[model samples]
Target: MADKPGNQTPNTPDVSESDLREMKVDELREEAREAGVGAVSGMKKEELVKALSEARSGSGGDGSGEGSGSEDDLGAGPDGGKIRRGPESSKSLKYSQEVTSPDEEPEREGRSLVTTHHEVIKEWAEERGGVPATVGGTEHDDHLGVLRFDFGGDDSNLRHVSWDEWFKTFDERQLNFIYQESRTDGNQSTFFRLENPGREDA
Candidate 1:
């Protein structure tokens, strides 16, 4: 049987990849947290699975191993196993790369897919004076340099980084949306959809 939300017991059975696929995003995120994967609550199932799998095998999180492992090799453990991949690497991102905007904006949606247009982002940044800088290893810096998330609640501290660093980590982590909200003063917060919004495949 599937585990209930907020009731994940210590004795929960091993979750398989197929099972993980069937679970809700919140469930997948809980499982990812149990496995010590980072920034998974904001990810799609496939991306969550990949990240959890990477965490299990210690591939992407740390730069330790060499040579790519078998893709078909699902990890073996209490959690559904992860596919082993080559050593994690970083890539460059195009600051001017166009982001696909969503058809509509949902107010107060914690994580919503939005457009990745540069002009749009520039205007938003201008409102805030400059982009939020990615700070040191503080608790708020939990999301690498991609985002500023507050693990405690909805009061997420949105930070900013250079367009270069932002796009690079965005691609590396396979992210696809921005957490949206309306402050008391009637302003907005946004992030470009890093993943191809229209693609079904991971």
Candidate 2:
């Protein structure tokens, strides 16, 4: 006797390492959490991919996997992978300097500074009369869709949001804020952009 479609067991494919590698770190972390992997918050992208792969393979008992307990395995930094703070003088982020604190000065006028620090972001926005906001109609259920700073603009598309909500989404999305302290002419500029290193689309 043939089984009904509703009663039939679906063949769900196992998540592969290659597939996991294609996903962003945040997405992988969510997968790990759903797979019962512990201590996920501290894991790096590579660590998350490894753990999720193990869990899906059924070889990872309790889904803790291996190498997930040590601080080194978690990440080597003061931010513990949650926040990235540094000068980022590296050539990879060409023309951009890392700013870890609100008090840090830009390398020079018009020099772009990048950071994941909440304080720096907040200070930069507030200094320009900008407030935390999200694009209206861009929400996914209770989750915020797109983040923006509204400088008392007349645009009705922006919806005001609490700093807490903005930061929560920012961290969750693993975003970096890039902005300039001043223009080349040394004037206060509102130039800013958001970037996600994990996703090409971002």
Candidate 3:
């Protein structure tokens, strides 16, 4: 049977010595970076191997080799998976809102979550380019054609929802507001909160 990542002991190396020997220096450097060993761009293969070895050992072989950065800082779950959020720097009350949690698995899956940076979307919109999307066309029902988001870049990756459907779900989720960010497709992506719009200072 194939071994699980958690099966490795601290003493056991994740990458075999033979594998490290076969990997190029660039590959070694990338491995070091993923392992969160800094200053590896100039490192030789042997140095990279040692550094990565240490990182793997120190990480207790849980498969996530992330170093000192907090999970919050990395914007990932404890398992090093991406969280459904936006960039850390975003803080606009105008876009502030809570996220609606959907079902675990739908009978029919919807579109993947939109992960493009909001800035990119805005730029695309300003350029007069819109993401190609469809709404309300299904086996059970069909509606009029394509929907585009002038300022919401690449809604192609996002599921389409009618305003009525969206508002219903939104209210059900009790989202009071919404916000967005620039870093959307990486370990660095984040979710920010906006100040309450009702505040006089806001």
Candidate 4:
């Protein structure tokens, strides 16, 4: 007997790899979580798809493959989960390397690095006297909105904030920081941009 069009077994995934690929990274992560694919917070889009596929097929041992470790493997989240990987924002600056730790250095000058590491982000901001900040009047009921870095610029609407506050909001929103250490000419550069891959407008 053939299964009905809308009826499928519990082990059979209704979504396909191509369908998963078309979905945003955040959406993929959510699907992974709902499917009982563990350690998905740090997974990239491809990884999430693979994990989901494996889980659906019931062939992924423990459903903990590569890059599938507890949240502490990367950075601990406020709720003991791994630091999330945001979807690449449309407005994100170009980055050549992905730095997971503060100790990692760029392979060349003017190279852009993307990271969600707290230490790495803090170091990068401090190196150029950048302070955590938020856009004025963008607050939502005591929650900071539109995070930014204040480099002593003339932007009077920027409100300086504590690192704790900034990071709390950062993780809550699942954002990635794109930045460069120097210009292509080897001069100090203050180029940095924050992106929330979870947002359609990000």
Candidate 5:
């Protein structure tokens, strides 16, 4: 129905020129060879047509116009469409320029895991601060609460106080974790777990 790409031959039985135009490029090359159009690859389009005409008309000669290459000749495999994968950089494990050894208390540890700090907080408060927490009411579930906060630029401090004591002393409506960028409603904020020491049932 459509004129595709192809070459014309000049050494075969009589064939119409319109038929040659309708053949595909690959198909025309094949026709030239079958019709004895020698050195078909060197001929120009016009020459190929002329040769094919002469050959088909019983005048023998060799000239066929076969294309040099095709669109599919270059890169038609998985590499053409594939996206390669590479190693991903990790987001955690941030490191500091300053370095400090384990013996440097209240100092910097350049690249340290955080779990060590939580454990240290629990231990130090129990040993030095007597685990004293000033919390409010029976909210601590019988356990004194130790709230860790980092008041921006004031240094992070773990305050071990009773839940009831804290609740009573500070208004829950205006309290917030020191490190949080946003303000917490004092009435709605309290991180302490006030435990009932005398109760056994849930």
Candidate 6:
């Protein structure tokens, strides 16, 4: 059975490829204590693959390939609610690169953000399929940049990357519609991060 957090969410280390390779039953059990292992526990490493398959056989949360909850469930509850909007979502958004602090540069290490984009991301997006995903970037003192994201463009839900490659691009000939995600207001309070913080409406 999966263990639930009881007023405490333990910090789970990132499951590295190296760690997965050498996992033992006892080690897996410990991992379960940290992050519940479910049916994947006690199986020989070889059996791990098959057990994961069984767990996903309508036993886990995601019934559809998309994820756990439905569209209406978005913004409702943290667990079942879909906080991150997908490309196909009607409440999707568009992205534009903005360098906030002049002193802020892209950090290649340390702090990495799991930001989304309007299916317009280039290289990584095209290579990984048109699906929306989070990618890593280097934040530095002089250049803290974000991958531009938005909705509607080339296709019903597609994006464009700028030629600079570091920035997002849109085809001059084609245009549709774009919307940005709304963050909450106030500090310590969860506010939707405005695309351009300097922008007044932002």
Per-candidate clashes come to 7, 1, 9, 0, 40, 28
TM-score of 3: 0.24
lDDT of 2 by residue, 63-163 (tens): 46455444223221234223343343234356588776544688788898777767567656866778899999999999997999999979999999977
lDDT of each: 0.40, 0.68, 0.37, 0.68, 0.34, 0.28
Order candidates by lDDT, high to low.
4, 2, 1, 3, 5, 6
Cα displacement (Å) at residue 202, model 2: 1.8
lDDT of 4: 0.68
Specify the poorest-scoring 10-residue window by lDDT in model 6. Answer: 168-177
On residues 78-184, what C-alpha lDDT tens digit does candidate 1 reach at each position?
11111112233112122222223211334443434233333233323433344534434532444554343222233335544555455445445443333233343
Off by over 4 Å in 6: 1-11, 40-42, 46-202
What TM-score goes with each of the models?
0.27, 0.56, 0.24, 0.56, 0.24, 0.18
TM-score of 1: 0.27
The residue-by-residue lDDT of candidate 4 on 9-40, one tens digit each, is 43456656765686666566556666777656
Candidate 5 residues 1-202, lDDT tens each?
3352232333335567776665544355446656676544334455556666666676754422234232112121222211112232112212211111111232232222211222222222322223434323434674434333222233334454542343333222212111111123322121222112222221
Task: Judge candidate 6 at residue 118 and give its lDDT.
Answer: 25
Candidate 3: C-alpha lDDT: 0.37
Model 3 root mean square deviation, Cα atoms: 16.6
Which ten contiguous residues of candidate 1 have the minimum total lDDT? 75-84
> Which residue pairs does candidate 3 place in steric collision?
86-190, 86-191, 87-190, 95-178, 95-179, 96-177, 96-178, 97-177, 97-178
| lDDT preference between candidates 1 and 6, better one | 1
Is 1 or 3 the stronger prediction by lDDT? Answer: 1
Please list all clashing residue pairs in model 2, or write none if there are none: 87-98
lDDT comparison, 1 vs 5, better candidate: 1
Q: Please state the error at residue 58 of candidate 3 in Å.
A: 1.0
